[model samples]
Target: MNNHVAPRAAGKQVFITGAAGGLGAAMARMFARHGAKVFLTDIDADAVTAVADEINRELSDTVAWAATQDVRDEAAWIERLDQAAKAMGGLSVLVNNAGIGSLGSVEQIELKEWRRVMSINVESILLGCKHALPYLREAQPASIVNISSLAAFKVDPDYAAYNTSKAAVAMLTKSVAMDCTRQKIDVRCNSVHPAFVRTGIVAPFYDALGEEEATRKLTRGIPMRRLGEPDDVAYAVLYLASDESRYVTAAELVVDGGACAI
Candidate 1:
């Protein structure tokens, strides 16, 4: 990606889930900085509202609206998208970034918790695509950036639910892309797999371990010898969301600091 700023996404309309803090907020800022009008959504209404306020103030050149929804709710998806469309005039990009982490083995995880994780992490993707694809088709040459984790390609005994959920996200990205091709839609779908980024999403992992231990564990196998920045993933998202990735679809963009390569 270019280091200097240019309005690559000028006049675009973007709707992002989990847009309160961490990577979601980072991507929202990046999109706005690139000149797209953004709609920020999160289950945490106050946090998302604060996020929208911050973005509006910080990036006065672009526009943003805020909404809150449980991503797992199909009705919420429809209603939120309707409001987002009206707020932004149209929808051009959808970022399925809302998700939660689960830290337990299958035997250790309760069935209800497993279902809850699945609902938030996986079902939400289905709901987003189902509700957004129609409007996305109307706004052709649009993009969907699904935030799958590098855990999808990895495994840990204590993270079965999260691993499974993210793995579903990875495959669903491809399926959505192929289906769009079949229907001859110009919308592209892709997933990003970020490993050990220093974001609130990884806070639980850090808290489970102390700061020093958590840092060591998270960065243990990565070649870069450090955790990733939110901007690292956000830049990749910006590229995917912009017209620059027009030819790219049904792909996994790994921002793992070369850990996957190892």
Candidate 2:
């Protein structure tokens, strides 16, 4: 408990996936900083542990912990979320942030690869929402933040699998949100669409396209003419997670730098 830390998320129990680095880690850090007890899970156990350790080291009291999870595994989702709920007393937020980058279009991609991409990017959302609902409702005023991508709306031929997978997430978020509301569940559901944040996720694109062309392509038609930061997305999640966005659900927050506007 840093004396200066504002407890915007005080008493919140947050479970985050793919939290070893990049956007997931950023969200974990911000949530913990705002006084949420966060369970940072990832397939990379050691890396997630390091992230939790880093956050705990900075805070006066323990606010973040780590777990290993294969988000694509439905059984793993059930077990890991139960363990996280037990550790946190209950869960108030679920950030289904684990995903991967897939290259190649429908014309070139293998069936196996498309399944792999959808399994990670889209299936994980379904599993997390399904498995975490009970605990989230118990914690009332809870939120499920799905980390979709702008590719969901601005499709590229080369990013066929990735775009399609994110599109599924986009629609899934709305479906879950509506279902929760209709059922009188206290949980909120939303998706974030961030364009090409400067995370390592873009490393593959840069390597594939070469630096100059990749940069140009990524920023093309963007009014900001710049990439976004993980914190930019995390801030949006914070607003949605807190009581401020209590009435906001079944929504998609576009964190892209106006790239989608054009």
Candidate 3:
């Protein structure tokens, strides 16, 4: 990586799942901009390749490489991590950001949908940590940032599967952090809970309400009076990934614009 800031991440290696999409791609650019070698992967191979290519072109650092892997597959997680370790030279950060969104009540959503969401949202984080633990232990001073949601802490009747999965993520992060501490591993694990981010998953939902109506309705519960942007959560992820949050672990960083604050 080149043109790096004079800060901690100047030479670090970071691996981000869901690299083909919104938050994941933003994270890749943010870390690369700060001089980190980023390994990118997603189920959508072409999209991830474009993201990596764009990052390399924009930064002239040649710091990103893309791979195709389904996060729901545990064996694929191991393969991807090993590949990322080789590509980035070593793995120092892992962002478990790949997840799906679903909208339905418990009675409304099919069992298959619930299972799929759990497999991707909650199970993938577990697999990522399980497979990457050895590499993180070896590297020492590593970080795992799992992308959870504000719905994890709130009751969203329309999105039971998503809410349940994110809730599991919160506890999963804590469990991983505790195990790392007990095992004498110099690793930090935390979950980020973002609310109503204006990403693809939420855009269509908002589109039905229209921009003005959606803005008013969504912010009604949030004291911050706005929906979060991808960069908003990206900054939080960067903080947790960097040494600045070295003393912070097993914590839930709520990036919900104070929605749950009230």
Candidate 4:
């Protein structure tokens, strides 16, 4: 089998959220490397700017830009996306990768924490789709990839808020896809469900249990017996964002290590 990955996203203009580090940063780099211009955003102004600078420096060109954004804020979404579309000349891909995880069983979790998780993980996607649709529709053949999680399907009792929010995202993706298709729009929407990727989101697991033990514990249920790399999920996002998946929408692309199978 040939292992070469083609530059499938050439000429695509991508907007990624939570792009300071981890999967968001990885996706931004992958898109830039594969010939797409990426506009990255995160709440951390300094870190996101640094990430954009690092990518430009590495590529020796300005294929990437960064801005500070709070995904839960509708006004911020409108402003940031407008700036990004202007910077990139157009926006063809919007990756809703910004999200937060909440730990605690339903009974233990407070209302504020639940709302926080929902606002970031679920409502943000709604806002992104609502606001980005105009730009995406103008760019036709555009795509929106929402970063959900395996927990959406395979739930963990302690992560009640996170599980509920991601599940909502999966359904919301389908709703958006249906709306676009019903209107004969070329914009596509999809959700990615990744299992235990090596990003800051999972850093707590390593901190709670040292890396060695954490890896073993986390991998015990995974058929591949390993944690996923950032690129593993990034590649999935790349496919969904690129024209390669022009016909794929309202789909959940699972990047799990066969954990969801059983």
Better of 1 and 4 by TM-score: 4
Error of 3 at 216 (Å): 1.6
Least accurate stretch of 10 residues (summed lDDT) in model 2?
A: 1-10
**TM-score ranking, best first:** 4, 3, 1, 2
- Residue-level lDDT of model 3, residues 170-258, one tens digit each, is 99999999998998878999999998888787677577988888888878889989999999999899999988898999999999988
- TM-score, prediction 4: 0.96
Question: Can you write out model 1's per-residue Cα lDDT over 132-234, one digit (the tens) per residue?
Answer: 9988999999999999998999788899999999999999999999999999989999999999889886788778998898888889889998899999999
| RMSD in order of candidates | 2.1, 2.1, 1.9, 2.0
Checking candidate 2 for backbone clashes, the offending pairs are 1-61
Clash pairs for candidate 3? none
Which prediction has more favorable lDDT, 1 or 4? 4
The global C-alpha lDDT for each of the candidates, from Candidate 1 onward, is 0.92, 0.90, 0.90, 0.94
Score candidate 2 by lDDT.
Answer: 0.90
Q: Higher-TM-score candidate among 2 and 4?
A: 4
> Across residues 125-179, which tens digit of lDDT does each residue of candidate 2 receive?
9999999998887888889989998989997899999989999999999999999
